[model samples]
Target: MAVPGMMRAVEIKAPGGPEMLVETTVPVPVPGQGEVLIEVAAAGVNRPDVLQRQGRYPPPAGASPLPGLEVAGTIAAVGPGVDPGAVGRRVCSLVAGGGYAEYALADHAQCMPLPPGLAMEEAAALPETLMTVWHNLFERAYVASGDHVLIHGGTSGIGTMAISLCRLFGITSIVTCGSDGKCRAALDWGAGHAINYRDEDFVEAVKRITGGAGVDAVLDMVGGDYLPRNLQCLAEDGRHVSIAVLGGAKAEILIPQIMTRRLTLTGSTLRPRTSAFKALLVDEIMRTAWLFVAEGTLRPAMDRIFPLAQAADAHSRMEAGEHVGKIVLKVR
Candidate 1:
């Protein structure tokens, strides 16, 4: 299969508001060695995209300038070292950028088959969030069965996924939410207790739930003022993984507390990952997690979807923090 000459894409002209996103025609990218061309059907919206829009984040060297990070589509072409027959298969791929386009290039190793009941939109939403959660929870934090886990931003995509993953793995979970509605949502998703951060301190709530011992691990996206509180909510030998600094990145952490409690703080990003690393992740998902997804135990909680041209509107909505789950963009 041969690649096309050009395709439609959403390009960001400059760092600013949602209005900065512009629709443009760009030459369709040809896949390099070990790569495939994806005829994108949908793309996922994430906080990184918002940060890129605001000029805080930029694509790494040798990556696309476009905003999108993950996409779902049919393979349009396969490059050298890839099976050309793979061109026709349906796949959702993790991308460094350029998923906002009607066509994008991805390494064959980064592509995952669509979940049985998932649409392109839902498939688009899965890669980034799932990769983040799995990497942070199981890989870095090593959340074990019956481990008391505390999750922040209970209504967000990461939070929803964390709640389900914790339940699926037999980890008792507590969550922090901004409102009663979000707290209820987290509870329904299998969280043991929900702290409305608006009305109460999650540190107190977590300590109370843990019988004053505190949680075994914490997944914190809320930084800044929550830093000290997060540490307080962790038990001896607990780990705290911060995936996002929504509040603020800088924090004054207690070194003695970390040493005394034997705590490990770590996090990683989906983008800037080595192809070999992601290939292993894809293999893990296919071998183990695919069955759960097929059985509906592990599934993406899809939210609002917008057409490719409406990327700006979608970004604006997500930045406003009104969404309850993953937001997707239909790139077709």
Candidate 2:
């Protein structure tokens, strides 16, 4: 494969709305040490990308300023110290940035080979959400088979993935969605229970659904007032893992609730983690979750696909919150 010197990419013209994402020609990025250059086939659109577009979340130091977190493609070239044989291999990788382009650079260790049956678009959708859910739900929350979990945003990419994984692992998922249709979609996706938060109280629904025992864990992406309410939905020794503060960053919690019930609250942001840590996460996922991918039993619930040039529209759909699953941009 021949690498290009310049490539088309979407750049943030300024911090603002989806319209700020402008297509332009820029020098293709070179892979640094321990990295490989990927000829991007597709890229996943995530909440962080939207935040970056709005200038709320800035790229970490030394990371790409462009807005893409995950991509799936073929290796076109390798940097120093990387195996030359890696070129031409199909892979999906989690990148810190720069995936909204014709080509992107990814850390070699962060790359996961795309199984024969997986589409590039599906592969592109997996990395960021997969890692976040795997680490938080399984690793941090310590959920096990038969455990009941409460997840917000039931129809979102992360929520759907969590529901699927919980089903595969024998855990039960109780999810909250904004609409009745989304709740139905979540149940069809194998969530044990779905609550339309707009119509009913999720805390009360979880209590009723669990026979007043509550859930073993809460996978919360919505913070603010929901924090205290989330605590009210947890069972004894239940874990609360906050992955995003979409509702609000600050919340007032009753310390007595946590202390009396032996509850645990924890959260993480993936982008700033060391490459070594992410590499280890990649390895772990390959050993465990990758088997489901290889068997064709696990795949992302895709919502929409947009051409690379229509990056703004892709972001627009994601922001509108009508999407039921992952939204991706086709770069090929």
Candidate 3:
């Protein structure tokens, strides 16, 4: 395969709105040590990308300033210490940055083989959400089969993946979404129950669904006022894992409830974590979840796709909160 000297990428020209994302030709990135250059076929649009474009979240030191977090494509080149055979292999990767491009660099360890029968766009949708949900729900919360978990944003990429994973693992999931249609989507995706947050209080709904025992864990993206209610919806010794603060960041928690209920509150960000840490997760996912993916039991719920040049439109759709699942950029 011929590698181009220059490639198109979406650059954040300034901190502002979706209009800030501009497609322009830039030098294709060269893979560094332990890295591989990917000819990006598709890229997933995530909330963090929106934050980065708004200047609220900057890429970590030594990372690409481009906003995308995950991409799927063929390896175009391999850097020093990486096997030359990696070139030409199809993969989906969790990139620190630089994914919104015709070509991008990814750490070799973060790349996973694309599951059989999945399109590039479907594979592109997996990396960021899959890793985040695995790290938070299974790794931190120690969620197990048969445990009842409550998920917020039930139709978003992370929420959809969480529901599918729970179904694969035999866990019961209850989810909250903004609309009744979204709730039905969640249930169809394997959530045991769905609450329309617009029409019902999630905490009350969780209590009702769980027969007053409450859920064993709660996966929250809405922070602010949701914190106390999330804690309230947890059963004794339950865990609450937050991955975003979409509503707001600050919250007043009832310390007494946490102590009395033996609850655990924890969270983590994926991009800043060390490559070695993410590699471990990649290995685990390949071993465990990849089987489900290969068997078609676990798949990405795709909402829409836009051409690479229409990256700003993709971001606008994500910002509108109208998407039911992952939004992807069709790079090729």
Candidate 4:
């Protein structure tokens, strides 16, 4: 297993669009203490990557400024304090940045062994959405068995994973998608109900589906005008977790409703969190979600795979909003 001195990576030449992503050769990154160098087999293309490329989201300080957030690969080397034996293991990791290369470095604490039979591409899709869902739904909202939850963007990678994970844990999810086909896909992924936001109002649909009561929790990515509606769609003491501001960042919230309902509104961005925080999530996933993955109960929904050099094309597909699941790069 000879590691190359220089490797090809997709770099953002300037903040703009997909075309800004260019393939370039650079010296391979060296893993620091508690990190491992991964020979990337695949990298998951995420919305944050798109935002980063557009200059809307920048990598956190001390992080690799590359676009990719997650990767699945074999370890090429391990830094001090990490087990040397980890060098040859197949793993999927949640990285702060730097996954869009042939070789990338990840904190060992953020890495998890690949599930028994999952493919590298599928494994690559697990880290970002999985950790996001787990942190927001289970940890923050404290979603429990039999609780009803609402997930926005139900066909996106996070949406699909939330639906499946909700089902796995005995929670019911009502999801909103942009089309009839996407709605059907969400339902098939185990959502209790799917609302086509294009055809129907999600707040009304949630009320109807819940028998005039409302969901116990909501996983929201569309922040703007949907905020007040999300409030209306929640039961007393319910939780609303916002992960993204896809619609718009500014929102006029109804304070009275929040006060009357005793609701909890919170949100988090994953990249800026300390390594210790992510490590806690990794431990939890290994103990719970990993078992489901290993048993073939939880599977990553893959929409498309593109070659490493076609990174721009992959981003284009994601931006076009036709993809129903995770998009990945076959890095090899």
Worst 10 residues of 1 by lDDT: 288-297
lDDT of each: 0.86, 0.96, 0.94, 0.94
Lowest lDDT block of 10, candidate 3: 290-299
List ranges where model 2 is wrong by over 4 Å: none
Please identify model 4 stretches exceeding 4 Å from their true place: none
| Predictions: Cα RMSD each | 1.3, 0.6, 0.7, 0.8
Candidate 4's C-alpha lDDT?
A: 0.94
lDDT of 3 at 66: 88
Tens digits of lDDT, candidate 4, 1-332: 68889999999999999999999998999988999999999999999999999999999989988889999999999889899988789999999998999999999999999866899999999999999999999999999999999999999999999998999999999999999999889888788899999899889999999998999999999999999899999999999999999999999987988898899999899999999999998999999888998888898889999999999999999999999999999998
Better of 2 and 4 by lDDT: 2
Per-residue CA lDDT of model 1 for 44-139, tens digit only, reads 998899989889889989899998999999999888999878978988888989989999888799899765676788788888888888888888
lDDT of 4 at 90: 95
Candidate that would win on lDDT: 2
Deviation in angstroms for 269 in model 1?
Answer: 2.4
lDDT score at residue 189, model 3, on the 0-100 scale: 81
